[model samples]
Target chain A: MLDINKVKQRIESLKKLPAIGSKSVKEVLEENGFSRRDFLKWSGALAVSLGLPATFAPVVADAAEVSNRLPVVWLHLAECTGCSESLIRTDAPTIDDLIFNYISLEYHDTIMAAAGWQAEENFEEALKKFKGRYVLCVEGGVPTKDGGDFLTIGPDAETGLSKLKRTAKDAAAIIAVGTCSSFGGIQAAYPNPTGAKGIHKVLNKQVINVPGCPPSAKNIVGTIVYVILFGQLPAVDNFNRPKFAYGMRIHDLCERRGHFDAGEFVEEFGSEEAMNGFCLYKKGCKGPYTFNNCSRERFNQHTSWPVQAGHGCIGCSEPDFWDSMAPYEEPLANHKFESISADATADKVGITILTLAGVAVAAHAAISAIKPPKE
Target chain B: MKITKKIITKIEGEATLKLYKKDSLIEFAEIEFWQYRGMEEYLKNRNYMDACVINPRICGICGHSHLIATSKAIENALNIKITKKAKILREITLGLEIIQNHIKWFYITLYPSVKEINYFKALEFSREIAKIIALIAGQFPHNSYAVPGGVTCDLTNLEIIKVKNFLSKMFDKYQEIIDINGKSEDLEILFEDIPKETGKGINKFLVLGDNLYFKSNGNAEFIKEEDSISLNKNVLYKGSFYEVGPLARNLENYLIKKVYEKYQDSIYTRIFARLYEVNLIFQYLLKRIDEIDINEKNYIKPTKKSGKGVGIVEAPRGSLIHQIEIEDEKIKSYNIIVPTQFNLSNGTKESPSPAQASLIGEYEKQSDLIFKCFDICAVCVSH
Candidate 1:
């Protein structure tokens, strides 16, 4: 038989730790209408999403509650507000509680009550108050064409790039929230009239990229919590994305990897192979090349992800995905030459190479037959 | 006089609104979209099919609609006939996107500006709807599930059961919002107190494509294609400044027609129409799921590649149309006329833009509410 009273006492003591002070995790959970069991389950899921073991759930929860909640100044620039949308709809803590209790979201134009000059004032005040302390979260790409006239945040003459520079000057560190802010998403696609570039290009500073079309909400929160607990950024890859979140290729973690190795592939939509859950590699899946934890940390509260839904990975999180990993329904060629025709497929080039070799061998045989051997 | 210039916030995308006042009364209002990404220019010389993936990034809220429109345009260009199962799945996915968009607009954008409601509940419901989308369409905000020929996903028994369970719960939740004593007349009563002319725009309405509710009549000649640039010359059919979205869909709805008769094109009717459409589409989706036959073919192979085509979808905001010209299997030119371009027009000869027209009155203090009443998506407008 379990000692219920003793268990409650132990939980109470755990809640009183410096990391989890008077406002216990249980209290916050209850306020969000979540039971203690639910909180535990959510924490465990968060731990998994953060690439940590299930046993580390309690530690993660403690770390989340221990540090002083940082003030987040979220700036929206010349891209869609999808990252903010994804962040607000996270299931665990509920966006209401996340903004109200977890972190001080000082300025977000889309959700903040303040508007016009007042909103600008709030941004300035937060910049001054938490100078060199608060995290600067930029969601969209910054346009640098025509002196950055494409995107302006406020009534002032400061362009999006100028504002980002000004804010980063007083920030502890910068977090580029989406692919737009990280690697210049669709806005930076070919013929980029606005000259939209990621934050790393404009501001000569290290900006941790949480790169997805709109990154999974759990990843966003996990990155922020890691910053809060460790008092520094996590280990990043060549792209500046945290290795924990984007360390491995999506194909390595895909459920369809067995089929890929077995050489079974879906040649067409709704085919027998597709129904049998074969590999989508032949169908323009960028999974083998793209690095993201989408397969492990599924979207929409772990319901499903792209490949699971029968589509190929578009390689959205990868840098220059729009230019490099395009023609989303076709396989990516191994080598590309700028001088070659854009429509020259890998099969065509391979056939041409094989034909040239065959002809050369035939010519050598003919020469040997026509003339007497030197010996 | 105290005149507020460039006051904008709480919207999906950014915009600048300048209000000119005379003796405390608003004299005129001007709206400008300061951001432009030039998506059309980017589409030139690219593979035609890539539009399905790239077009969705225009507006995060209505991305799936753009995806569907792009897919449809490609299908039109290639003359590919989609299977019944594919059509139904696409419709269901689009329905989910629109439902989520309307719910977000109501609770997140409109409700905060008007009245305080249980926003958490609304977000929860939207998340549930988004889960259905992610199940079939991969993920929300930028899912390119619907390709040129058909959808990339195929339904299984497990998905069917999951969808059925979700629909039942969604129906119950929706009933709680609109149903009163089993006779759902709550919307009518909720808008009875609102004045008829409040936020009323032009009387003209246009629907570009066929949906569960309305059938496409004919193509509206609103845009003209030039040598290199396509211009929206603001062509008027029977009149100018036509309304789209829920209001246009409800113009034909029998139940909403009763409400529209009372309040012509006011904000109350628009909100009621959206709420009504949400319930109607939810019921429609439940039936649509049952109509799906998993064994049937889902896509038809495309044969033709070089042709000009137009595709239109009823987006959450309004009618979203995509036109593409394919030459030698590459996109020669691409032009898109989103719902925002129509509703948030630069004013026509007959009337002002719906957004600007709504701001014309002594209600300068309520400009934000009036602006949001149009559910303006600046990303779509400037894309």
Candidate 2:
């Protein structure tokens, strides 16, 4: 169904442009929907669509070899591996291809084949070999409770907290890839037992945090590209994430923002109001409080994100996505409210009114029956 | 020997794996999710819409899955039927997440665990793949695009083109990745001379199955309804206990035999499977883009209805189900069952936990084995 040659030829043409690669050229084409045939038939038109320099297609092959691929060491501590799950699903460059040609991933625990002493050996070897020149990506927060027994790496001399600290010390830069590593996420929420913390607190150094339940692939890749292209970190937010990615609020870009502003909400599910695509705010949409481009970058290769799926933003991008945002039905309340508290919709109003009316009638009848006897 | 193996450090939430071993082998194991947010209990008597907000907070990576599942649950409770557009939109969003999640795990999570593979490049590759998807959604790791009745965003022709282009880019990347294992005869011979780590032969793989055919118009029909996987859905494992997570989802799709037919049941097989998913989803996304008629109705408005509703979807982690009871515009009772519950729950006498049951007679290192069998997210578990 998709013409492969036309795509390849256009990619070849785009490769000729300055600062472009097979990867980037392909990205422009895919994002703009210029099939290979489209490229072959209308390179100029496709170029205009992607806002590309006209000379891109002629010389891309020469520029494709500048691989500033860095070695990355990913550390996990207190986490659910959801960040890991999120990381594996990048549709644009697809992780597998990246691993094959672009970057030199030296060591990690989950996807690697080496285990036990050998796995640990690989980590140590990579540390010594790639020290101060590798990228350190942390997915989970570190537990600082009781000498960090909350997490350990292999029933050995090294604890997870200590290993993260040790590994982070030698890295050129650290990418905190998830909310857990960014701000301790839920493990550190509400009386954190392990004293779980983000990389900034544990490492005693500044790290770029790509925060989210699992940060989008663009933020992660764009930041990496910025670093690769410029040999330095991109401009970042106060939270240490690149400003380019974490700049917008979910509500600002929401398609249903008009409905929210109009105060037209779905009062009940399966109701005509709900079927009509009303606002989910009263239904607990957190687009107002959350920050992310979910409305713009629908998940699954731009297919859709959570909100488009007929749900509301749950604010997974913020710190403490679990504890701070839970009782998911209630609005953001001040402290002192119990965690996981429900909202008022659970008690149907009709039942309460019916119960009250029935009780009143029964009371009156009993009273009348008793009055006759007394008289 | 009484061996106390304590596994901790968390991603979404905190959890500890305490294993009792005999002679350096696991005799028994207990995984305790350390954090309990009590969200389910707190959801009592709350506005049904609250789920959209709270459920996503259950776990960051799968928060989108929670948002969709929770919304479906509320819709079910209210006995509301969302529009075909809305349903397809939900599926697309989830599919995107699945693509992102699978790539993340394959490169960031699974590949890192392998001793022979280089993961820094993997991270780069993974991020690039993520970036393409992010361009459309604008960011990664997490995106909140769903609303109560439909998504808050709409795609333009240019944007649709952008998605198709991104998918094409992903295909090129996938081909390159496939080439790494020596797809080229010359390169294979050159690489073969150099000693490299290969997969230890293991014939164990688990998968969830989705074998329903979509109509030419792109609408899917259900073979049966069982919380998740309404259209000819089935869960299978070698030992009756299949795996769940990115690996399982990829395997399921692979079993459907639409994408990534090259690799199967090896270290590279597993890695390539996840990578292929990114490419495969691109095809699906392209088709979906065409199927979406902007002029078509986005949702179906529902009124107060007295009935129960159940919503189910295949989460990035696995099958997620949410059931609720609503009477007269209010929730009478609410129940949510996440994929982790089915995968991690202690099974009946006849069956062990899907993850645990698969661990029989396999005396690999506890940590490595557990990571392979399951993606344990305490945040999803406790929430």
Candidate 3:
């Protein structure tokens, strides 16, 4: 009971914007040799990925096509370029369309054609031209130690920290793209030699965080599209992640939840229970604590996520995951401390408590036997 | 007269290339990786197992390679033995990583720079390969699926079917690329258009790690000695620059032995080697997937203890090595020599580094193409 003609009409009007009307969403898909059916499928999948109903696919398609694509300046700092790579490697819209049709990726160090001074010049021009309007997407963390000397950006000897601050001053909003940019990923782990910090800490602002080791491409694109459509940042959780993407714990919607509740757990990898697709909680899955829509919006075009692949979630989307999520093979919230000499203090304490309880029970039984005639 | 210092773009991470030119002929080219996060230095005193998760974040493209390397290093340190099924799964994941990486390099990075081949089709193929990776390794870019003793994931029949289907489709697409570029089934023709002497470096090839597709050529002793002695801030082997990655892997393969015999080390050979490996690795992955038995144990519980060990993996780019010294179950000191450190090192007094030497000629117009031939990953270099 779908009105294909009405949907096409809605798409037609949506593609009428002067800035983005040159290539209709349909035309863009066709240019990429994708049919209208493929576009609809993508829109529906994107809607689901964004935690919206299938009926909202038309609205998403319309919002994506009609809105004037924002000129995005993506910055890379003291971390890997994985976020950008993930964005480009998405299968739904194709990376080419996402770059060319959706957003004006004015300056990206990894993928841009301009090199050296020219690239720097392009960034300056874009910043000036779209001042107080453009959206700044930062992928990596900022190294704040030693006056930000750890990570430098341009030929002018400008550090990444300094550059980010200057660029963010005029930006309408910022999108912290990955865990590194959002929560000082691995670089900010123990010892943190270079003193890397996320953008929120450096900027002291409520930048929308898409916090995953490398967040799903759909979430990244969906958040940006929401910004363009609503002319404001989407609703975010306490962690500054969009509610649509990071609203619920991965455990809430995990496919293995039934098994978890049924008390069928995978104690060991490649065990019979593991082969039968039991819950991975016992093997240290952090899905119950981690907040990300990975279970529903699986990576690589909804193929499969970590739990489905028989691995427990490492809680990459959470803040301070490196420190808080250590000893990945053990369950969270379970406490057992062991010293470097392999002395188990927690085990000793447990044994003492159990022995004392047993002795108390025996003493009470003997006392009761002695007083048996009183009742 | 003046050093043409320029910031190189279109690579994974950012770097500054300083061409010390004397007249038209370049005397030397020094590649300075200014972006440093000190990952190794910061890893000190942290839990040794955390390295498996942290090391992968060094470079997004080759994160799985790092994860496997870290896991292997920990396994070596603990003397833990993984089951055959776990080893096969690890190799499958690694194979998928390499295939996806090479496809992306060919289509996304290299083709656009060289103005050769269809980028979109190549992107689609790589995306499929990434799906296979995610199917097995949980996700691409950063998945800590490989723990110390074994991988976290165990294969089910459903996963096997999914991976097999994607692999077949990928094989077909790869053949299409060969057909379109080479006019034959053989992929060597795809490199026929590549100019000789382009991006040629020292003939010395260094390959480490053993997998189903690739095996070290009985050079373990030499590799260990070189790994221990020559690895510093400026990574070198036997006091000389050496090349690693696809070209090195291809030099050892029999299928592409003729190509290696013809062109020892050049841009043409490097590109051909990468393309050849895509086909070679795809076939190997399919066979490995079929060989996997889900009934076997996937991991052995690792005990907290003190030890020192070195782990090496043939990453998509080259050999990724991780050395860990554990004291009381915590990492006392850790050293990581990424493949880029081997290929993209700053030159020592003995000779110009491989990356620097490749850019010595007057090919400024084809500088990006020449650089892409090396598959430069600045993130790994800086890490």
Order by TM-score, highest first: 1, 3, 2
Interface RMSD (C-alpha) of each candidate? 1.9, 6.7, 2.3
Candidate 1 Cα deviation (angstroms), residue A268: 2.0
Model with the higher lDDT, candidate 2 or 3: 3
Q: Which parts of model 1 have CA positions greater than 4 angstroms off?
A: A1-28, A52-56, A66-68, A91-104, A334-375, B1-3, B180-197, B222-239, B348-350
lDDT (10s digit) by residue, model 3, range A75-183: 8888788887787677345633443324644787866656567889999998998788778899988989999888887777789988999999988789999999998
Question: How well is each residue in B1-383 modelled by candidate 2, as lDDT tens digits?
Answer: 57564543322333445555666665554445443333455455544554554456566666767777776766666666666655666665567666656655544444334334444545555455555544433344455445455554445557657766766676566565543232433223323432222222233333232311121111112212232211111223332433344445554553423322443333344344445555566667667666766565554555665567766666766666666776654456766656565455443335555544444333445344343435455566655
Candidate 1 C-alpha lDDT tens digits along A1-375: 223344334445534533312454455556768766665665676667666656567755655554334567888887878877677666344532343334543787776656667788888998897787787888989998899888866676468888999999988778899899998888887667889988899887789999998888877877876665455687887789988888887877899988876778898977888888899977888787677888887788777888988889988887767776767777764334442233433443343333223223422231222232223
Q: What DockQ does each candidate score versus the true complex, computed on alpha carbons?
A: 0.48, 0.12, 0.47
Worst 10 residues of 1 chain A by lDDT: A364-373
lDDT of 3 by residue, B62-157 (tens): 888889889888888888899888898888889888888887777666665555444556566667778788888877878888888887676668
Give the CAPRI rating of model 1: acceptable
Error of 1 at A137 (Å): 1.2
Per-residue lDDT of B71 in model 2: 66
Q: Relative to the unseen true structure, what is the C-alpha lDDT of residue B367 in candidate 1, on a scale of 0 to 100?
A: 73
* lDDT scores in order: 0.73, 0.53, 0.73
**Where does candidate 2 stray beyond 4 Å?**
A1-70, A79-104, A113-117, A143-160, A186-196, A225-234, A247-375, B1-48, B54-68, B76-383
